[model samples]
Target: MAVSAEDFDHRCEPCLVIDQQIEAHGFCVDCQEYLCKNCFSYHQRIKATKHHHLVNKDNMAKHAVIKESDECTEKCQVHKKEVIKFFCPKHEALGCKDCIVLDHRACDIDYIPDKCTGIGDSAEFREVLRELDQKVNEVEDIIKLAACRENELDSCHDRLIKEITMFRKEINDRLDQLQKQIQTDVDRKKFTDKQAVKNVVETCTNISSDIKQRQSRLQDYKASQQNGQLYIILKQAKSKLKSEEIKEADRSLEKTNMQYTFEQNQDLEDMLSRQNAFGKLALSSSL
Candidate 1:
């Protein structure tokens, strides 16, 4: 069938180009469609950009519906809930399982259990933060340096370009004025005059060629130096800081749950039993 823009538009709603419906599933989590792709607006970005309306197949088991895996460390603090990871209070460093095992072999070790773990006692957390701060500062430093370099390079480039332009203009002017004078010569001194003009042209041409080369080099250098390399380095620094943020949050955490002393059930069984007896007596007495 010959297709046109008309096939894609209808009424106030966007038209469905295809009529096929998902008979099995009522929705597509990806497509967000009761029908086919043609029937749905391609909602590309959402808060959860990955979520889509998808229809379930007829034979799909309700019990077999898969839930998204919790890929993030939501509840567990010691990344993957490994065990009693220890941090050296003296050195203020992170200790992996192997590190803790080897280092605490003889010395007094302070193991931070996953439970009852606190930032107050977490040197590793503090260390990671310190490391992040250091990296961010380093990036900031490089950016500052790059900015200074860019300014200096740009100034040098501009001066060279200006010099080349001035030289090129002077050479062109001399060549043009000399050529015009020769062309307009009226006297019979043509032979001598032509030779003199030729020499002058050669000299000016050589100077112009040299200036062109200098201009090209200066342009190349300026372009390389002008792209805000300093700014990009600043961005890289921020990106590194964010990465460390993820690293710091990775496995070290202490989540505290407030506990109340109404924590246990008192002896309410007798009271409940009496209430139940009273209700039964009322029912019987009414009858």
Candidate 2:
């Protein structure tokens, strides 16, 4: 209860109204009256005025006036219109009559006004307040940790994506180099094989022309009855036919069948077949 400043001769208002002069010792804000010591004592005893704000004359000028509604009218959270009047010891909660009937029927309850006596200065109350503050701080720490972890998650995701992209780029660059090298090899092989086939064709044509010339000479010799010259030509032609150079040419033409094939890396193929993800995700609290 607080009192406000107002012009006064410091006389009891109730006494002055009855044409009696008495010094005021206190002021009742709700009644707007000044009272002597006796009247102040009676004011404290009476139930109606007991709850009213009262300030002694010694402290009246030090405080502002208290409003009528300044007294706490704490209402039930569940039943908003009903004042909280009961305390449940087991649940450590305040409730209205309806709450007691609905939820706290089996619990031993006490009238809140009676239960509140000396509670404001109790050691248990202070301890409860300390525990509440500690719990609140712990929850705040957990919230901060959650925020940090969320940011870290995003950072890790971005880093993994960049790594995967770099790995893919490296593989693509290597494959491109391999493709160019293989294509160059194929071209060089085609050139060399083409030259070998041309040489074989030229050798076969020269041999056939020599044989045809020999055959024409033999026919002329036979017509002129030159049997000795014919015999020498036949022997020379037979030796040339069985020569190692001619046999080697025949083998070279057969060996000239060129074919090429390419195979993928087995490890790379197995990785593509078996792997579904780039890497596994692991969660650790201690990091």
Report lDDT per candidate. 0.47, 0.77
Model 2 regions more than 4 Å off: 1-85, 94-99, 102-106, 112-150, 173-195, 216-235, 244-246, 264-268, 276-287
* lDDT of candidate 1 over 163-210, digit per residue (tens): 778877986798689667755653334445555556555655665675
Model 1 score (lDDT): 0.47
lDDT of 1 at 200: 55
Q: Candidate 2's residue-wise lDDT over 82-151, tens digit each?
A: 7776778899888876787778877887765444557778999999999999999999999999999899
Lowest summed lDDT window (length 10), candidate 1: 10-19
RMSD of each: 53.8, 12.3
Clash number for each model:
9, 0
